[model samples]
Target: MKRVAILVETALASGRNILAGISQYIREHDDWSVFHPTGYMGATDIAGLVDWDGDGIIARISDPAILKNLKAKNTHIVDVLGNVQKSPFPLVKCDDRKIGRMVAEHFIGNGHRHFAFLGFSSERWSFERQEAFGQSLEKEHGQVSLCHLNPRHQGPAHWHRNLDHVASWVEGLPKPCAMLVASDQFGPLAMKACERSGISIPEEISIVGVDNDQSFCELCRPQLSSIEPNHTRVGYEAARLLDALITDERTSETLLETPPLSLYTRGSSDTMAVSDPALVKAMRFIRQEACNGISVDHVAESAGVSRSVLQRRFKDQLGRTVGDIILSVKLRRARDMLAFTKISIPEIAERSGFNYQEYLNYIFKKHLSTTPVRFREEAGR
Candidate 1:
């Protein structure tokens, strides 16, 4: 069997999931066995490393000195993290700019005027997200304030700690503001800062983060909303590229992998309206009970509004009818399940509030231009 070395440290659930998806893809159809080294070492260790013949390597590190020292020019190198700016090997990475724009658009769509961004002090991804977010806001004729937390900033020890700075910044922003944290870890941190400062989520302030790590999001009091970066696709594509290199199938100078960004709506950033209360309530009902076979009448009745009036109001405000809004919500739910869960098509359809599998397929194709199976496959399941 062909072998590949995997060097990774600072493992998180998101990273593990990415690798797991890649591993699954490789295991079923290939003769490759993955090897993991103990820890991340820079140029020093790479220079002295001795290795038996293996096809290639997939790694998160992209330090120039390290890759150069490894002296494995003949071995195919797949860089999944995109840390290496320029490399001879193929590269796969989360669509950071799209993620930033997605979060910005989502916040603006929900009727947020004042905005804020919380992220690491200095990082490439952070800069990318900030730039994209600012650009999107400008395109929408809006603006956002930014508060960066230095990586070296100690918690509470330094008077200028990230959380303290963030809390101060949040206190200054106008009410009903939406803040996007760069990473999932910072979501809860930002929330805690809000709690300490007497700020309420989605009411006084709204928040979103990148990386849809369930354990991290669910653990927060008001479950965090996040952007799912399609890490699984990144892994799957990385594996495919590595396999090609292993077999000497193709020799491309550089390969870039891009995936669509998806939003995982949750409590922290679930505000559906500021202009109309009834519409927001109705939309919330549709989102919650779409899987329970709810209808327009049901949503109207639940929101204490007449069906005709609700329909007119929804159309006027959202540019879509109440029924269409419900369908959109159902489709989005179905799409999320198809991408994240291992459920069958029938189950996914039902869970997403579709009457039948064929209906799900039809609507999925109509709206998303893809079948459920294809979505899962592309999602790296």
Candidate 2:
């Protein structure tokens, strides 16, 4: 049996997912004994492992001392964390550029003209994501504001001061701007800043973040929307690479980048920034009632406009017809359910406002060019 030490934090959902993937790999392949010291926020000490004589190490190396200690073991190693400047071991992580472009596309599709990015100045991943997001927006003739918090700041006092600065910046932004935060932790902070400044979420401002931690996301007043990273894939790949390293099958510093699973839409970034009150009402109605089998007539009636007027106005402002918007919302929900849940196809169809599973399959193939089973399988991999 190979002895492995997992030096990853378990406080965050990402870490948990990674550990689960590693566990799955071990169960399928070989008898592996895993060791991890228990503590909060990855506060476990690496010094204790000096005499454990592990065969391999998988770690999110946050400190140089940990690297030094692990290197002394002369074992096969893989780094799962992407925040470090450089790593001698193989690295597996989410594609930060793809993440940024995905968020930009989602915001732009919702008709946002103004954009912003909130992240830590000291983190390499944050900078990469911010730069990619800004470039994507600029490509579409949109403007993006940038904000960075110094990583050196610590404690509640520094946090409050930073929150004040963020609130001031948010208050000064042009109305209805979309902001993508770096992580789940920072996303709620942005939302709190908006609340302090009296900004209406998804109305005056919209916010999205990386790492779709559902518990953390739902904790905010307007539940946060986030890019769900493929951490499980990251973990599985790390295990595969580490196994190869243990057997001397792989020796190079390989970097594995996985695309995100999907964007988990929520109340925080759910609306478009169109100025027409009727259009706003129609959109709100569609978002809330789309899964209930509501039609264009219902949307038109809710908006207090004729079907012709509603269709024309939707095309003029949102660039999509009434029927298309409803379908889009329903399809988005369907995709989310398929990716995140194990619900039956008939149940998924009912919840996604499709009349039947056959129709859902038809539309999925038409738009996505794949069956729902294949989509779910791809998501799992």
TM-score of each: 0.67, 0.75
Model 1, 25-118: lDDT tens digits are 7877678877665543321235223654567777775467766644554677787766546665677778888988899889878878777888
Report the Cα lDDT for candidate 2: 0.83
Local accuracy of candidate 2 as per-residue lDDT tens digits, 198-295: 77677668899888987788788667899998888888889888888887784565888889999988878877777677886787788778999898
Clashing pairs in 2: none
lDDT of each: 0.74, 0.83
> Judged by lDDT against the true structure, how good is candidate 1?
0.74
Give model 1's TM-score versus the native structure.
0.67
Off by over 4 Å in 1: 38-53, 62-74, 152-160, 251-253, 273-381
